[model samples]
Target chain A: MKYCFGVDIGGTTVKMGLFQIDGVLLEKWEIPSHTENEGAAILPDVAASIEELCEKKKIAKDQIEGVGIGVPAPVTEVGIVQNTANLGWGYKEVKKEMEELTGLKVRLGNDANVAALGEMWLGAGKGEKNIVMVTLGTGVGGGVILEGHPLVGTNGAGGEIGHICVNETETETCGCGKKGCLEQYASATGIARLAALRLEKDAKSSLLRSQEHVDAKAVFDALKAQDEIAEEIVEEFGKYLGHALANIAVVVDPAVIVIGGGVSKAGEILLDYIVKNYRANAFFANQDVQFKLAELGNDAGICGAAKLILD
Target chain B: MKYCFGVDIGGTTVKMGLFQIDGVLLEKWEIPSHTENEGAAILPDVAASIEELCEKKKIAKDQIEGVGIGVPAPVTEVGIVQNTANLGWGYKEVKKEMEELTGLKVRLGNDANVAALGEMWLGAGKGEKNIVMVTLGTGVGGGVILEGHPLVGTNGAGGEIGHICVNETETETCGCGKKGCLEQYASATGIARLAALRLEKDAKSSLLRSQEHVDAKAVFDALKAQDEIAEEIVEEFGKYLGHALANIAVVVDPAVIVIGGGVSKAGEILLDYIVKNYRANAFFANQDVQFKLAELGNDAGICGAAKLILD
Candidate 1:
């Protein structure tokens, strides 16, 4: 069976996975992402590790298809990484540099977009050609796959759902310099922010006041036990995210919306809440969109990255 | 040059356009629509028009590429128009029927979606593959083209941007049985509603109080003449439409947004207001999306419908 490599570049670590061309992931590993001096060592480090793996396995280079990579940046249509903020990259022609080093074909994709492909391929969105995925971690990450193709927009910023304005009247600004973004209300950090706001509003009857770290997990746990304040916090979060998603549905009209990332572990409870709000806000014809939790977990980025080359 | 026919099926009329395969409009005409019996006469009427045109022009059937049609309905991938409400059509095999009747191939599309294709090909979004078109007439109609292809959702309900919820607390219901839909605030009727509310709220100081019919055009005229009440009403309309569009941009990230329909006749005055609000609400990368008036006007549907056959 032909082999291929999938590389996922993050701010802290670079993840690498080995897979058969038909999509059997055989092994995976990671290495430190060297962002010093404009990330000069990042690609070189990835190249070296890949070469070492090929040598150790005695796998002929001819037997491998190519490499697929996911980066934390808006990728232009021609394979230029517009900006990998975390990797300290700026307009890097990754496809060319990587191919020249490895002497193999290379495919480039935005990390969140690649993970979305992974989920569609092997996780919650499997079997669906049109789907939207929102990774609700510290911040929200989004990727829309339309007609079995990742929507790499004009500036490779097509599926940036996190910044969709949910509330225009807000005092605080989002990390992306936007105000009242969906990310400010629907993410893991956003949930905790809501939890804090609720605690401050009703300090006398709040369950979250006792927790040292009032994180999303604590809020959900409290809600599972039927805490009033926790319930309200989760409800508000769901309303913002669900409504934003409904608005998104009006554009692509995906068959499913996959919920993933650190906060999605809230699982069915979270799904149920988001679905409730989604129904109320969605266009009449698109109100029946399926909601599913991502199944591939942490392996999504690597798997999706691999798909770039395979596709 | 080869020839093709474009047909637009609407509630009151069926517009027909003859175009060269090289993207030139050769001739055009229209016929009264007969929706008297479940739209049974619609396709037959369309067939007659094409047959008569072929005979009049002495154009052989083999010299024509195919007929492209746009109907006010959700058309499934396989060519079944799910529902043509205005035409009284329900789940009709339009493509098959038209092909059989004409003895030539046929392509089908939703009206709004076809107009979007038209705008992309030869109207406002010309030369751009990704675009979103909003037609703000008595109601709002929307279509999204991604990678130059119209996004027809699972139920053929894709690109239904009019119904995206901009406010959840609204008590009044929209025609689609929803509350706070963008359609309720962004359509020509919606603009009139806003104008009425403004007149009521500021009865003592409104110029619209003197007008017999406070339609969208009247409101824009007052705004053009620097009426304070008119300005407020327009701003409110812009906010709703702009914010909703920003939410849409988070998904498709189009290069341009084309505004069409009767309301768009307000032209640059309306375009500037919407663009201002859109820039404020859109994702940063998408904030730069160009705004333009739909150039094809009444011909967009016919022109875009023809694209279905050529594409």
Candidate 2:
């Protein structure tokens, strides 16, 4: 009857979950992330929250196995995060600090990577040991889970799929100072940018022309309404992301590709366009790879973080 | 003080090596490959070869660890090769057949994959656990090694780098029935195609005009002579391979990229063009990935096959 805690640390709020070692989540909650003062109080606050929960439940210290953490940064094999722009963290020893505070072992991983792991463990990619997860939020993020483990590379930069160069002829730069990255075309913001560019280039009679704010949702909504211009925009977005994912499949050969994040709320329709383009671009032998929408939604981070300690 | 055998099953010949478990090559030989009878004779031949060698060396049965085999096809985790165009094999149980025939335990892997493993063990990628090997011969072949083992994907099609569609607009189809795959421009034959296209379009003054047969070697020879058209052709080749590799780096984040095969015979100069284009297209975090030439040459297959048993 041992239990564990999974904590997902973000810039604004920290999500926490208590679960049995077998993965039945008993309770879940959130607290404001104190990123001020270089995020010095972040880990300590998390430790105290878990301690309070155990006290309230009248649980003994030995009843808990350890804490699993998902952080918004590249994490070294030893649990050191060299840089986290959102958290104002620089070279912090996340694992050691959390262990010292809670008197329990700790496991840490990159947030997006752990989310992918969570999906593989109990969500869309359940039972798949080899899977690739693409998170299409404001910015595109990715996690490659091979053999049920995240590929944290040489500089802890493995699974940085957003930065993959999808187009070389472009002049504009990405946030990471790269030109024509997948993030420039596949993210929520990227989809909105496509709609804006489409409107500016051609004066096509479409429903999107009347919307004051044309976001990713607006584009999908327009598509549902059979807007011709929206179809073109989604097609272009599908080309970039699907082609990039096909290239990824060639290297890692994942059995499944799980699509997640804010943009994924558009639901099953998104998979149709992506799967079409993916089949056209993928290596023939790898064309059979399954595509699944992430089912755990926001809870993926916490669930995945918990799985890390169990691993 | 243990010994092992490495067998590389090729289309024309079977290359065999006897090695001490420490990786020292004791002796090497070759045997004709009889593709008759649906290649039914292949495994029995390989088994007999190993038995004869053991007796010749007076090596006791227990003195040998086992035999490792590298085949010219996609191999499942359990050592079943579903298809092999070169070997004329169809759904053959390679491991089972070999073990039954020789009465010795055996390990099996794909030829290109084991070659990548061989390179990682004692060649250019020595001591490295994460690496990507690109073989630019008649056709492009690839083997991805992560954490010191080859990435044998779901259908054993992992590391099929050649078929990654780099240009979606290409008119001519690749050998694999794909359009604009990496192999269309990166293989030795691909390099020759680039030369032919350049010579036809612009009618530029170049050393290739005087050659009887223009091939990859002729193109490199012209490049060494500083021919303008040759430089352009090589640049085109570099752009396709370098950009595709940059995309690969974004996913796997390997520490080194080892170039091999026939085109690599041009030596250090080939790496210069590839590195130039790769740096320009690579993600900033992964720009530091090192590039090296394959050191083992033809022996990579046998050496890597031996490594399978060791793994």
Candidate 3:
């Protein structure tokens, strides 16, 4: 049986997994990324971890067809991480360096793109040929899978959906210095921020009584209680999400759209509103597309990385 | 020499052209399209025109390898035009009907998509594989070319950039019944509306003196006279255009972006501002993509339809 290794290199942790060509996960593990270290310092530790896993599993080196790495950075088509704002790395040939260390063929892709690939390959979009996955965590991130392959553009920066402009009135400032980016309103932080602003306006909500510091979960709880302000915020959030998805539908027309991340934990409450508004706002002809919740949760990274080689 | 016939079917007219394998135009003609007539009624006139062209050029029918038609409507992958808004046709098999009339192979595509194909094959996007072409006419229309082919989604609704939501606050209404779409600010009518709104604010500008009624060209002319309000309007217009393009750049990261249509005639004065703002607003890694003015002008429709077979 052919096997491959998939590594998802995040800012703080690196998730690694072993899998067969059919996408069954055999084993998985994690390691501290220590991303602060220079390029040379990080490779030896990564190599050591891989070698330890191979020995413990009694897996032959020849059985491993190739390794696929998902880095939290913008990569060139040829596998160089051009620049990662979170990691502070610039123009690093990650694939070549990892290949040298592990003595195996390696391919690298952006983290969002890889996660999207993972969802398409083994998760909610198992049989889908076209899918768009949005992760609404601390920040908004997305990946586009078109025709059963990741839509990696000229420089591998193609699927940066968070940066897409969601507002034109210059209301909120994004980390990238742009105002009114989608990430400013749709991510976990954005939702919490909206809740806080509502609180400042003296909007009555059950959320303030239970939690000293409000978060996205608090907002969800308040929504369930039918807090007028929380419901309004949720509605607005859903509208933006639906509007963005509708536009994306025009560009990609994917068969399925999977929503993941901390805010997505609200489940049907969030999805119901998104679907209601998406159908109403989408171009008249595209009201029939499907929207679903991503099933893999956090394991999406490892599974996606593993599936890269198979794809 | 091998040749192919490209027909661009519009509401009022049909533009036809013959193209050689080397992407050169061999012959071209146009005919009135009384689209109110049934699809069957329009067939013989198109056939007669093609026969007359062949006779005039002394070219044998066998020399034409195939015929490609670009219709102003949503098309399925199988060449059926599904309810074109302008043509008022419902579920018509354009390729099959044209093939029966002309006794040749036929391929059908959306008009905007075919125009992008034309630009990719023989215009500004020559030699580039990934491109996005936006036509800023009365309403915004877009085409996306990825990996050298027009990206026609499953429902054939891909490349609908005009409908992408650029505003979250819902300040403007779009013709598509959406709020704050990119078309509300970037298209010819959108610019004229902006200029008229500025005039209402009692802003001082030569644009007021340039024309009896405000239009996109009048705004450009006023900007040339260094009118403060016109320059500000142009600047604001540029920002919106830049914001939309930046979002598009993040999603597709095309090698080149071709801007066409009536508003594009504003030339460098408009392009310089858009390019500068786009660079500032784009995701950090995608700063190197090129933006160019489309060169094919009005011939894009026929040429694009022609190049579909060659591509």
The number of the candidate with the highest lDDT is: 2
**Full candidate order by TM-score, most accurate first:** 2, 1, 3
Write the residue-wise lDDT of candidate 3 on B32-61 in tens digits.
886675544455677788888889888887
RMSD value for candidate 3: 3.5
TM-score of chain A of each: 0.97, 0.98, 0.95
Q: Which 10-residue span in candidate 2 chain B carries the lowest summed lDDT? A: B196-205
Candidate 2, which segments miss by more than 4 Å at Cα?
none
Query: After superposition on all CA atoms, how large is the RMSD of candidate 2?
Result: 1.4
Candidate 2 local lDDT, A71-160, one digit each (tens): 998898899999998997899999999999999989999999999999998899998899999999999999999888888887778899
Model 1: share of native contacts present?
Answer: 0.73
**TM-scores, all models, native as reference:** 0.96, 0.98, 0.87
Which stretches of model 3 miss by more than 4 angstroms? Answer: A1-4, A31-65, A85-90, A97-105, A168-172, A203-205, B34-36, B41-65, B97-105, B167-173, B200-213, B227-229, B276-281, B286-288
Name every residue pair that clashes in candidate 3: none
Error (Å) of candidate 1 at residue B50 is 2.3
lDDT of each: 0.90, 0.92, 0.82
Worst 10-residue lDDT window for candidate 2 chain A reads: A149-158
lDDT of 1 at A164: 88
- Real contacts recovered, all predictions: 0.73, 0.73, 0.72
Residue range B1-311, candidate 1, lDDT tens digits: 68999999999999999999888999999999999888899899999999999999989999999999998988988789766678888878999999999998899999999999999998999999999999999999999998899999777888998888888788889999989988888999999998887787745677788989999999999899999888998999998998888888877888999999999998799987898888887787887888999999999999999998988
Residue-level error in angstroms, candidate 2, position A7: 1.8
iRMS values in order, in angstroms? 1.1, 1.0, 1.6
* Residue-level lDDT for A198 in candidate 1: 78
